[model samples]
Target: MGKHALLSASASKRWLSCPPSARLEEQFRDEAGGSPYAEEGTAAHALAEHKLKKALKRRSKRPVSDYHCDEMEECTDGYVAFAMEQVELAKQECKDPVVLIEQRLDYSAYVPEGFGTGDLLIVADHVLTVIDLKYGKGVAVDAERNPQMMLYGLGALELFDALYDIDIVRMAIYQPRLESVSTWEITVPELMEWVEMELKPKAVLAIKGEGEFHSGDWCRFCKAKNTCRARAEEYLKLAQMEFKAPPLLSDEEIVEVLKVADELAKWSADVYAYAQDEAVTKGKKWAGFKLVEGRSNRKYTDEEEVAQAAQKAGYTDIYKKTLIGITEMERLLGKKKFAEILGKLVYKPQGKVTLVPESDKRQEIAASTAEADFKEE
Candidate 1:
């Protein structure tokens, strides 16, 4: 597969929701190299693919030495185990179940120049399952009504529907770092219905560059988010709101403002960072802002020499020792081995209460329960 498809399944959530974004993003050139986070994620995926393929006795000719790391090994091992569990479950239901690793899926029928690689695909009697490995911990991806996974399902259906008597499609997102394994199921007919109705129209508009720009949470990952006129207008509406003497706002108004504030803050920060980079690195200047050296602390030219001089001066107090962090210890010993050895020594305390939006997935604590717990303490 090509490095990037114009309407790539990964960005389906953004472009499908805001069809005009596909064309708008094409106007700007992407940064030359991937971000550190993207590179880490890519390495993790390579390791996961290697592990899975090795387990299946389908190892690639390419060496996995460059991608091998302790953390990557652990994360990929978990992903492989989870995927194998799903395959085993499928095996129980079908006479011959097949698992495909890093399978290239084509969704061009529903999206122009769209395709994505499924980390794992399992096909069994009247059922197809698509598993995706997400190494990033920035956001928890849900499988429910996920357009990306749905498009993958469509691609898998195009490839295997004729071969297998598939009726149900299962989409799973495995984020091992977050300990999240979310799965959602839909009938083949329902998926096809969505493709025929919602997907095809949007895909056509996106490909033709003939749709209106609408901003929401979907703009979070859009390349043009920082400078998008629609987003600016949306946030500007909130900024232009009438300011009372005490800045009193109705509950409904507060809710509306809160919804836009998060995205607005992120956009503002992104714009600032982009402008700073342009000014300092590319010799481009903004009208009001000038680049300057950020605050930093002085450091010794040679730490070893400084340490020797300090010790020779009878500075014994400079030295200290401490136990390794729990996370580092667990990493060194391996999670299971560490838990087996020191399970009883570890204790988890109740986390402090914090305010969050109602949409947060965490269960809310009752006031009575909090009072009762405090009394017991």
Candidate 2:
């Protein structure tokens, strides 16, 4: 853990997974420009905070909807709506609503050691609530024992301790994508214990950057993917696999064969680029072995004319009704059904996109569209 440790939700996960890499990244985060997605998330959170404070000031609970709020389009809208409703309900139903605050600030331990930013912290007469809005639909957040929320709760209690007689501090993870809210009622001692025992130690280790690479699906999105030694070795070994068709080559021969294949692949790419450039500069059209000067793209024009001629011959749709590529397949099968077939009908471990049986897919289309291949006359 360094002085510039990121005390955010994502930081914890990264620190635990790859401490060295996380430390390297975090230490140089300023040099690494902020991600667009992060900027969007921050913008959405700001909007939500503003709306909540506005609702509190007016003593009215009005729903805040963001039509073009891209950062929060996924979960912010729904979570913000639910939280506003809860605040309004608290005012209307509860005995006395104390304070509805936007960005009620708090910190863990001390500034250099532990620090956190809360999305929203509300303090009532008898209860304290901290709400975190998560926009991602991929992972559902649970508030119970959530370190991020726990840290937020700790900060809130510390800040508002002297101001109000806070009895119970409740934390909530409001996920709009799931249309769900999970709450955790924690005592002051329990929260303190969690922070000191679990969060602080973890935070220390994270700051120090002492973790191992625990491989998982999320590795696909990790920045260290290309440079990771473990991944590179595994991929190299996998690539070296033989066809097993014949045992014609010895160990040395096999190595040589692979080297030749690798070299050929690189050479082929370079040659292709050179040939394409020369053909263009020399004013010669090249397709396969055929070459012509001052003329290019003959095939597409010729094909169009042939298609028109075929139409004249009373053969319509003559662009060759070849097996539609995957893109066209997706267009033909709308998003929902295509997803169903892709996930449910397809096999696992190898989550490959697969087409369902013709009859089944057609039946799905018929049911949804209320017609079977309804081509206009």
Candidate 3:
């Protein structure tokens, strides 16, 4: 097995939903080097592990040498502090609490050849808590029914069941960048029931490469997502719809078309990005597309000297003092502290109304507002 398992816990959400995705991805080699965001996440994880180890007085051979940065330091500190709070709570409920950081967890019983490192695990009496620190800010991850966290909980239970009697499993996602901490709890029996009914069957088909290819939001991070035939067919299905004038379609039909149009736009962007990467980096070319410089802006070689010259030429308004943005101010003061200091001062205006599918989590506008707006005026 490589650094990451074929049926990795992090990718459980994808494979469980689209069983063939695991086997499909094996056909292509991962691109060289890591994305900047991924690298930053790794750095934040390293710092968090180091900080936690130091707090527990455990010696770690690895050092946060290359991953040391101000932002990472603060982010990891926040994670360690939050995890310690959970640990303290567990300690209060039980006589003794066992805390482990950066522990290797194995879930081969449920997933074929699966294993992953858990960021933090605390076992006390009948409660087993798994805390995951997500440094990425792109999306907010919730713990409720999250396949990844459930897999981690299973692995933790497998490792410590012999020593501890764990009945309730609590999974938490601590996304410091998004200032979100979501927790979900389930009985151990319920979790195991899911493993037997849902996970095991999917793993069996996925390991044998005998499952159908289904696409959804889970395809966002797949290596072959841009070129996957299933996804291409899905987009093509949208294209096959008749191009009727907008005014002729009913309200319901318009909503359906809008959904398809959104997906088509995203698909086109993904295909374009993939083609650009292939042509520029791997020397692969499409029949009609050629790589060329898009645009550029002129820049001064010596910024300080240019500024001095500009000032000498009577350019005094070139620089101005601007207050830092709310995000940056919050980062500097810490999220909780910032809220305590300015919670009353900050007012968030209501966002513009948007049309979304029923599956969207946001609450729909009040029927009274809709009725008033459409009052036959």
Candidate 4:
């Protein structure tokens, strides 16, 4: 909890969804060394900050990091270019538009000690914009009504709302790895309306650690997700659906089941992982479970030695080569170079049909698309 508030903006999605989870999360300690993904993101942010500051003719030193690579280099360059465009636009509104990089913003008026560092904050008379850089590719982050970005908006407004005659607040997320750039804009009055009604109430409940626990997609990153009773009951309710129905689940029941199918599998895996960790590390054995060796395959301790031994034994046809994965290739060549070299040669096949909730951003494939596939098969 070094810099993490009990109701931090980053975990607002989880805490707001299940307010009591803020207190529940306090029971679990942070992972000792943090995760590689988070560290990589930090490195990328540091580099991006240096690049943006330099672009603005500010004094800053370029930082060296192990995570520096062609992909990061190109992405940060793109982010700096985007920041420069915003700066140019701000200059149209005022002669001296202030640009702040890696600034701490406070929103304690709404959230208790609710503050988060914004990646970039640009100020002008007409508009105030806060931009964030997302370095991960696992999931696309949209700024539309995003709790993290909105909180940052509140924080930024708190800093300069009176100083600047700002009518609109713009929050943008730049996720280059996913080829996503999202911006959500709201008038000051409209933003305050949401703050007074929704965000404030949620923040109050979260700070008090008082509210009914509701489990949903928000539980994905909750610290207590593995053992939370509310989550267990949510998934268990789906199992109970089998007996509650007559002989088969009706259409509505089936639809409800489909909604939580992915979450159900995830919950099971989380429980299994927790149980294994407890048994192995804490020696807390389950009633009917015991630790045992898992399946393994033999591997060469040193691949070079293995290759030499194989060649010495007259094994000439030992290796097979395949084209590198698209992501790795892109990183190797940089985005611009990759496009110039192999853009036309690349093609994407239709993905296998899968069911998802209506809220998913992907457009629904035409019924004829699946029907045509069936006919071909």
Candidate 5:
């Protein structure tokens, strides 16, 4: 189908985690704002492609040594700089390095049922090496069996099958930021299975706008933060446990209590749905729970206001709050350093506000307030 209809290797896994509606929302936004991690990885790919192609043209000339060393202007900039260096180093070493095909190769059909773009494709000694670059911090990429890389290999095999004596499709993950390389060989049948099993259904669902909600740590980053039933249940119980007073259970007992919490969570959703219906139909109030629709928290407004206030309080420069996005820090301090700060920014909804828990407090608290008024002196 089209780019909008197609599911990439990464987005396919995301589709398995949550139902189609949620997955579609995420996949579409991917094009709109371009994820920081993706942007860096793509930039690295572009830089590698550029340097490799330049080296190919000068295969007969002296090596181009004037490398751009500006202190990684951004995530993409860092990846491009580091990757370009590697390409130059390769150029010096290899006697007959192949062409560095730029972003022109569209290897969609090679991925079986899935469609993916190969980052860099090279040809040497009649063998094809498809190198995929990963610029994220969490996990070191393994190329040998990477679904994405495999698909890229499949694409390359198809494109160059007739031109050269195809020996083998070699796949690699050039994780520059991690200072490592992972690689694998792609057999024809294995690639076919990936297409039939993983690619086809995921693509269909993605195109049709349906997704399955599977849960794990990735749920924390999901955009449908408040809407997920399983996530909602977990957080609601955690909040309730926080407010629990007296007779605190031991660790083992706490685990047992969580089983009961699961039951309570189901009742809670049912109750919430009933309340939402009443609010909309009977009470004529907006029904759905209040969500964090893009919060621009902690601005220099308070800083500016405070700075102005401080100007009156006898201070000149209270310096604008040095706010930095997590992505920027990753470029400056590297991925390891940036992750420390990013951990705190995970999405946790304001679960209580606009929430109609089982208990209503006004009637129960009115008598206590009246008693307190009479008892006060």
Candidate 6:
């Protein structure tokens, strides 16, 4: 697998769950550097590294990026502050705490050529902590039983287990955008037990592409998600499953539908987008679907000219003015200044309740009154 490992630590979730997907995804190589979101995440990581290095008293130059903004600055500052806190905690037990920023960790001992770059690694006292920064806010990341963090912990152990006699492994995910700061601690023996019993076997199957294809939440980041047959089958099954019940659905049936509703909608949208692109770009057509001119709203060729003409014609009411949104206002003023100036003026109303699966980590709302309380000013 050239420079990229077949069982890369970042993609471990997909491979470990559905080992065959590792090779299946090899056929669909994404475009260079992936999507705009990926590029933004890369920049965030670079900025984080610069900030953390400087915080640790190491010489480093500040990074320049289009993504550099108040939000990125605030997030990176939070990350550095967290790392410094860990360092101080480490100092309580050990004379010298080793902190590595943007550390290249190799866990090839457990998996074939398995290596990943961790955002931060702190080796102090008997704790080996691996902290990672996730810049995206689309999905919240959890540190509990996360393969990526576990793998990073293993790589850190390989480097300092003997030197520090590390007994405990701690992994944290610092996702500032989601306001997520999750940390999970495990004993060295417990981590190794998981490696030997679960990870090693999964790695072996993933390298050979010998295991069955299983689909779940892990399919989100898979490269072949849009085109994979297994995913299509899964979503199709979910969609068809919805309508097969009786006219008046039972409580159990309603619960079952809720499990797959969100996933089904996402899959349908992805398939439609891919199909539309293929029909337009490659002249690929499906028998049932046909190309047609999509609906569009009218627009002026030159807005300034149109405005001038309208004013000259005694029609000066073309403008519609409104106050900027809360987000825009916050962006206009920096987060701190915004809070200081308008904190009392702003109030978050109660959110309307929605039915989500039990596994959702969000606290259950008081549905009895939540919907009644939702209102617009």
Best-fitting candidate, scored by lDDT: 4
Candidate 5 lDDT over 162-223, as tens digits, reads 77665666776665556666667765566677778876566566556665655544453445
Q: 280 in model 5: Cα distance from truth in Å? A: 23
TM-score for each candidate, following the candidate numbering:
0.92, 0.52, 0.86, 0.94, 0.49, 0.94
Candidate 3 has a TM-score of 0.86
Candidate 2, 1-377: lDDT as tens digits: 12423555435444445545555454332425565655555566666666666655654443454433432443555666778766765566456655545553546463234555677777776578888776545657677777667667777877777777777788888766566678888887777776676666656665666656543333444455434565445435535766454486577756655544543454445456546666676865666655446555645558778888888999996554566655455446644566778646544442223334342322333343433223321
The pairs that clash in candidate 1 are none
Q: lDDT tens digits, residues 227-304, model 1?
A: 889888878898687755436877677777777777788878878877887788899978877777789999999988
Candidate 6 structure quality by residue, lDDT tens digits, 88-120: 888887888898988888999999889988888
Kindly provide the TM-score of model 2 when superposed on the true structure, using C-alpha atoms. 0.52
Report backbone clashes per prediction: 0, 2, 0, 0, 8, 0
lDDT-sorted candidate list, best first = 4, 6, 3, 1, 2, 5
Task: Tell me how candidate 4 scores on lDDT.
Answer: 0.89
Q: Which ten contiguous residues of candidate 6 have the minimum total lDDT?
A: 368-377
Better of 1 and 4 by TM-score: 4
In order of TM-score, best first, we have 6, 4, 1, 3, 2, 5
Give the true-structure RMSD of model 5: 14.1
RMSD to truth, every model: 2.6, 13.1, 3.6, 2.2, 14.1, 2.3
How far out, in Å, is residue 229 in model 2? 5.7
Better structure of 1 and 3 per TM-score: 1
What is the Å distance of residue 341 in model 4 from its true position?
Answer: 1.7
Q: Which regions of candidate 6 deviate over 4 angstroms?
A: 238-247, 370-377
